[model samples]
Target: MGPGRIAGVVTVPELAEGDRLTVDGVDLRVRVSARRRRFALTIEPDATVTLHVPDGRPAPDAEEFVRAHRTWLVTKRAIRERTRPVNPAKRLVEGEVFRYLGRTYRLTVADDVPSAGRVRLVAGRLVMSRRAAADPARGREALVDWYSRVGYAWSVGRLQPWAARMSAAEPALEVRDLGGRWGTYEPGTGDRGVGLMCLGWPLFQLPMRLVDYVIAHELAHVRIPGHRGDFWRLLRRALPEYVACRAELDELGRRLWMGEIWWGG
Candidate 1:
């Protein structure tokens, strides 16, 4: 790796012939792609190396750029190695591991609800007591319902205070499906009232702080209508480290937030 490298792998798209660069302490493989529209760099997961170039650029120039970025490439490779992907399949089984509020919970299927329902404990696991005829789809719905009720009750209790602090008329809250977005707000309250998406199962897996962050964000929009600095200021006042919560919410959205249980007006 060289001295002036930002990522483990550096890409140079516009290189001419006779250009050469070297690395001092890193091993890298370079591949030149025939098609390149612009200069870009990508670090692979395992720290493997590849260099791409436009048709007009010379191969030598590309090699030099790769050599110049050797140091950065090495560091990025290390980061990618540490961050592993969470498996969604783990939640599909009974007595399996799952996460909620930054804590772990195991799945426990209880077929005897006494009133057709399901439940999960912070540590014990999911308790599913449904009919024998219930299939995976029904089981999932029953489980999701349990999550939705818990999320809704928690949001109203913990999040309403933030809205109350704004000293504005409390906007009428509505519940509905919002696909990827956890919740949303509209100016009018008739057909377009604030729509709160069902958090489903995955949302429970995140830290409570992240859930508070999302609720505050959507509730704030009911008053501000846009993502201006004031909106951010309001959010920060309610959640000092909202940025982290936002990142968590983004991760949750990408992996979870399936479109089901559309419950809006």
Candidate 2:
């Protein structure tokens, strides 16, 4: 079968939603940005296509551009499908294991109300109390709530010293389930306007050493906005073995970062 039109072709630059297209039966999500100078396309980590075209470019040009890259798109899509993880059994069950600060613990769903729904890594099990031990959905939500609280508190403690060490201003810190790569650093605009630093909740699930690496990496951006030689130099000064930590983070990417949890906040 020939490529199909996945959605109505987008014409106006002001249109708020992304248009869709199909080539060789592969679905693509097309976005038109006037700020672009040339055609750029990427298959996101989740196996979705994002095509950015120069502003004011017409629909026909976009379709043709996609046709030219059809081969690459098809190949990448296949690779993602091949390596995609089948959904594992509910991870919140009684016996599933999870990691915190590089420590592994079995999950224990205890219905002890006096614990006030607080979850902890105790003895050898990550224990949380809830009325329903059999309902995976409730258990997952409870765990996410717990992760958010602990993640934010822990991140603040770590970010403080790094900020002082770098002589960087203490920007507002927010930690929630952003569900993406490690975290992000955004420099603020004016004096008295503190910049904002956000840490993804998933990073909290990994080891604390890796967590510090991400925090330091973001803090480095406060001094060097771009990831150029200067940025690397700054980061290296803070963490002497940051290169090795980066590679290790990549190795752990598939196991933790690619999960289908709620990408909240």
Candidate 3:
């Protein structure tokens, strides 16, 4: 229910939310969820390991689960190490390149005008006001905002067809920064009857096909809440080529610009 730190292997009556422990030299954060029917292990985007345990599960059970999956944990971590993001920082300078839907657009800093603080795509270039470009923080904000606005608009048109194929209702969608995740689906609640989908703004940089994969993946979650076999089977039925798209997304995603800025001397 709460956060606690666990060191080494020690038997405890129950595992609390956020409880941390090290097993086989690998650190894991415990997350006790009522929705979980059994133990599951997730390798997070940051390469941190999470042990998802059902509520009321004992600490020793968690340890045993991790030990059981030691091989998987090691292999996944190795894959992550090989595929870690090598995204480069961007400079808000003349002719700097940015991407949208797999197309490249050079940055063109414009003179400070009434609309100079905004970023826009004009004539195959990303134009920004000199005032915003001069400040890295402002420039980053403007670009991220542009991505969110454009991404939301693009995803709105794409949601329905995928939803129809998956037999899921098209839910309320938004685009924003989701840190380490590409997209997420939250089941609908009483006040909000339709489920909600959020796609990270950074995800807009990928090609349309990969974007569709992410959309289909999230839509599948509307029917199946977890990434279990059932979920994958459902997704595979809708998009037979999902495996290739997933691999491509993982590869290309590592190279996308993540709003990091470098002001060269």
Best by TM-score: 3
Stretches of candidate 1 off by over 4 Å are 1-87, 90-92, 120-123, 130-134, 174-176, 190-201, 252-265
Per-residue lDDT over 138-255 for candidate 3, one digit per residue giving the tens place of the 0 to 100 score? 9999999999999999999999999999999999999999987899998887877899999999999999999999999999999998888999999999999999999999889988
Q: Indicate whether candidate 1 or candidate 2 has the larger lDDT.
A: 2
Model 3 lowest lDDT segment of ten:
1-10
- Clash count for each candidate, listed in order shown: 21, 1, 1
Model 2: per-residue Cα lDDT at residue 46:
67
Off by over 4 Å in 3: 1-13
Instruction: Report the poorest 10 consecutive residues by lDDT, candidate 1.
Output: 256-265
Estimate the TM-score of every prediction.
0.54, 0.68, 0.90
Higher-ranked by TM-score: 1 or 2: 2
* Alpha-carbon runs more than 4 Å astray in model 2: 1-43, 49-89, 115-117, 130-132, 189-192, 257-265
Cα lDDT, all candidates? 0.55, 0.69, 0.90
RMSD of each: 13.3, 6.6, 3.8
